[model samples]
Target: MVRENPTASLASLASGQSFALTGGTVILEDGSQSASDIIVGADGRVVAVEPFLDTSSCGACVDIAGMLVTPGFLDAHQHLDKTGVLRFTPNPSGTLQGAREAFAKYARTAGPDDIHKRATRTVERCLSRGTTAIRSHINVDKDAGFHGIETLAGVRDAEKDRITLQLVAFMTPHPGQDFDWLGKNIDGAVALADAVGGTPAVSEDPPRYLDILFSAAVKAGKPVDLHLDEHLNAGVHLLDAALDRVERFDMRGRTVFSHISVLSALPRRDFQRIAQRMLDLDVGAVTLPAANLYLQGRDYEMLPPRGLTRVAELHRMGVTIATASDNIQDPFVPTGSGDMLEIARWTLLAGHLRGDELSAAHHMITTAPARLMGLGKDYGLKAGARADFVVTDCIDTDTLVAGGPDRAFVFSKGRLVSQTATETIREKEDA
Candidate 1:
């Protein structure tokens, strides 16, 4: 199923031959190059990047005369399987509690085929949006049953080469439970996943949950990711506890806290202290603006808070922060098309990240997320790097973000895998 007006796919590249992209703006990590041509070899690695290249003996050539080319976007965090829940349930309240109830009900009623169909559609939509990499969290809790795991595995296989899907088996263990059984199941799931996930503060007590997850993470030798401190309550200050475990087990930088929403609730002094600790401990923060904002604060009405991590403070403290869309069309967040441009726009508005912060936010969806996923080194269209990237309509970072996703001429490993129409109607109306 190849797309119409497809770019050169990585598979089409033959050794010793070069494919040239005629004209587009190429955005590098540090700067942007206009009217550039990117050449790729048969080995699927970028052979050369210059303003002009001699085009000869190439297996295929794509003349994207009027487009903007940049590194393929990466959704650092998402929930593909749970997105299927949206087809049946509408979380009108849009609270965490409402989401929990809706997901529980929908998971029971939904089967693997249903999940497969929806997840596949979601992934395809993501790819069509020029998102080539996604770190998806799959629910492994009992409530989701086999449907979550089965759906996740199918998605992983179906979109493996086209899109990089790093699966994190997510679950929340009960407190005072038999540790052995919990560890066994979690470890078994880790054996089948790229990483391990837990929701330390999502449970009753943050301390106990962190302890269990940290112990399991240490034992399994897997990078730990906890849905830490998602509430606006300062009482659920699990960041310190999680760092304590990271120090105890020496996991350090390998641990990431997703949606540290309670970070903003901490007093400035306390926040600074924890930020320094996280910096020293090498822990990272993953902020899920889409789902966190939607799921938190069912009890509040006026001035509902942005349930996201303290991104500015974290950056000031030298901690790495990345924005993610945790749930797309799921109970947690009823709508998302796996578009990080949308996420960036929302982040810019909600987080008040402007100018340099905007630049950093742009990196958050591209290089920053890719590096966090441990796959960005070869991600861009640089010499010796894999020819996996996208061509968009906007020329500069500001325009790119403002323009949203206009078109998705995506190439994976130098082969044309998918393409999507940019919302040109919006562009027309804006004009």
Candidate 2:
């Protein structure tokens, strides 16, 4: 009975208590599904994920048979503070320059309350979409100053229960120039955020830019997440330069690099070599396909590139490759839904993931990002892990990837944070 309508079934169950999810086909790390009865303990941790569990004494059970069960999604790269601001802000050309210019204009006047409200909405939207974790980038340069950092910091704490929000203080200074504002406010942003990030593509002196970014993060004793080589320049070597900083700072496994779009411009041999280097350094790659697809390849007239990194190659090299929604309705790309599944769909299309590789595509949004953000100590649909996951109305990954499945329920620490069910309505137009 519960299988047909998980929303109504879950609604009848008490909140904050442990229960068993019976007969559900839980998605494994490999994207394959298995029939496993998940027994969430009273403490909101999974006690067992075995096939055909004896739930006779479960007291209460929710039959999730045939549903797609998996760990909650994680967005490794996001601009939460800038979400839903396009109403007033306009991006006419849809180029990277236009995005920066538009945001620069808006950021100058956007206050803390406004930033907070929009960020809150984005966080709530992500939570409802089964993304229980987010690593959002907040601007800390001259245009936005520390307002983005401060506003998102508050939202991080407020939404702590629903989503594990990690703020990365990202500097958006011009290439070859340093912003004086971050000099005094860098500590403040680092004090409130989990990591520090910067764009090396725009930095005229990429090496020097990385030095300042790496130094600040080291001083703050946090990991570094960088927006490296976000352009289509085949000669761009920020990825190689960043490896130096990561090695010098010994930040391997503690570092993540997003938007390595130029990596695709490298030759196959060089790309393979760099992929191995990334694995040896324990660094991960985060591809923001949604924003990249929109912002990149605009200058090219014919046969434009997908504006994405070599996701499959890096993954094949055992390098953690995660995908995320980088910007949400802001100057960058101008389109976002705060939904990781949507990002996953785009990743599949833009990244050229097919067949058996589909599971890897799913991993890009779920388990892969969790590992990149260092949240894998006890994650995934495993026994003794936190009972934080999502259920979509699909039998397998193929169905789920095809889209249109609502996040019937989202659980965080064994508490249902969001619940929804499809209510098909037939209506006639009133004359």
Candidate 3:
């Protein structure tokens, strides 16, 4: 059962036990931190964050010798239905084209039972790795039809207590086919949602398709996310149209662009102008590094595309950029363990973001994604904040990312929901 007031109840749980995190450095925003003791109250909110623990009035105290404590994770973008399809079919062709083909086959063969089983396993792994929330896009096309919506909604409701799942109804149209029918169906889906989705860049006439989709989104008064320019083709300019419409519709901060891989190949001047426009429009960007790197570079033979978007530049320009796994162990890119830490590791290496930037990359998995999910005051660890956190074996943000925690202690609204441990022992055999 879902608690009426999760945060308050978590605070009440914390008030009962005075946990002392000794010898561990706490990570904070703005690139600085100090040794801190966090006291959670019975009401499920963090009651106090101090330099030392004064446990005079507490009933129980956990001595975290030198482990790490950090905010729970939030995965920005994923496909719950597709993620579960990976167990059987692995992408052999290894390009977006091939993956799309494989997805078509898998969607036809896969059933709701299969999708749910895989998704539940994947979500369990995410919780084990400290992720508390996810934004999964459910395909609502003619193939699976309403099955995608119903199945994902079921997954959302089932996992709601453990992990917050936001649903994005994605509309995909076949090439050279009329999207009128698909468009009507998309409108119907949007009517049932808090937001809508589009892939105008993938359409035959991107400018026209963009107009149709965003206009639909505006009419629905829902937020929008577009899969724009996902390939590194120099000729692709659909992102410009998408952004232009956002400006035209005054949907600043309500519009988002995901997977604009072409920007990585654009000239510095051109990229700068686009970045500025995104900042002006308050539009966010989501990059799926694993999927991009895996599915991209297919058409090109040698010196293939990097497959990553202009992430660093966007951040430098104050654009909100988040990272996503996109597909986990599916027909596309085929090998994901459903852990956001793995996503961040590859992202940091591929995106060339380091040091403090590493921490920023961490945010792409945590608070940044939360911000995009409309989880406003419910995102962090503080007084009046939801008591959602993970205890790990690291001292600060850097260590949390670098040293994959050996164990994760998870709590949602003060109730222990999950715990994980990975044990390994290596020693010299015959010295």
Best by lDDT: 2
Candidate 1 residue lDDT tens string, 1-431 = 12334333423444355578766678886645567788888777788877778877666666666677888888888877777567577777877767777776777777888878888888888887778888877777656644676668767887676778888877654435444555557766776667778777556556665666666667777777777777899865667777888898898778788888888888988888888888898887888888877777667779777777787677656687778888887778877877788898887777767666666777778876766677746777678877778776565677778666556667777767675663434345654
User: Residue 166 in candidate 3 has what lDDT?
Assistant: 75
Candidate numbers, best lDDT first, in rank order: 2, 1, 3
What lDDT does model 3 reach? 0.73
Backbone collision count in every prediction?
10, 2, 13
Stretches of model 3 off by over 4 angstroms after superposition? 1-24, 29-31, 41-59, 87-90, 191-194, 422-431
TM-score of 1: 0.87
lDDT of each: 0.74, 0.82, 0.73
lDDT of 2 by residue, 1-431 (tens): 36677657866766666688888789876666898998887777888888988876665689977677878888999987688888777888887878877887898999999988888888888888888899998888877878888878887787676678999988777643554555666778788889989887776666767888888898989989998888888875777889988999888898898988888999989888888889999998899998788988888889989889987777777888999999888778677777787888888778877666767778888888988887775678888777788877777777776664754688887778887767779898999
Worst 10 residues of 1 by lDDT: 1-10
- Report the Cα lDDT for residue 59, model 3: 47
Judged by TM-score, which candidate is best? 2
Q: Judge candidate 2 at residue 176 and give its lDDT.
A: 37
Q: Identify the runs in model 2 with alpha carbons over 4 angstroms from their true place.
A: 1-7, 54-59, 179-181, 404-407, 423-431
**Model 1 clashing residue pairs (backbone):** 8-416, 9-414, 9-415, 9-416, 10-413, 10-414, 10-415, 14-42, 406-422, 407-422
Cα deviation in Å at residue 150, candidate 3? Answer: 1.5
State the lDDT at 20 in candidate 1: 80
User: Against the true structure, candidate 1 has what lDDT?
Assistant: 0.74
The predicted structure with the larger TM-score, 1 or 3, is 3
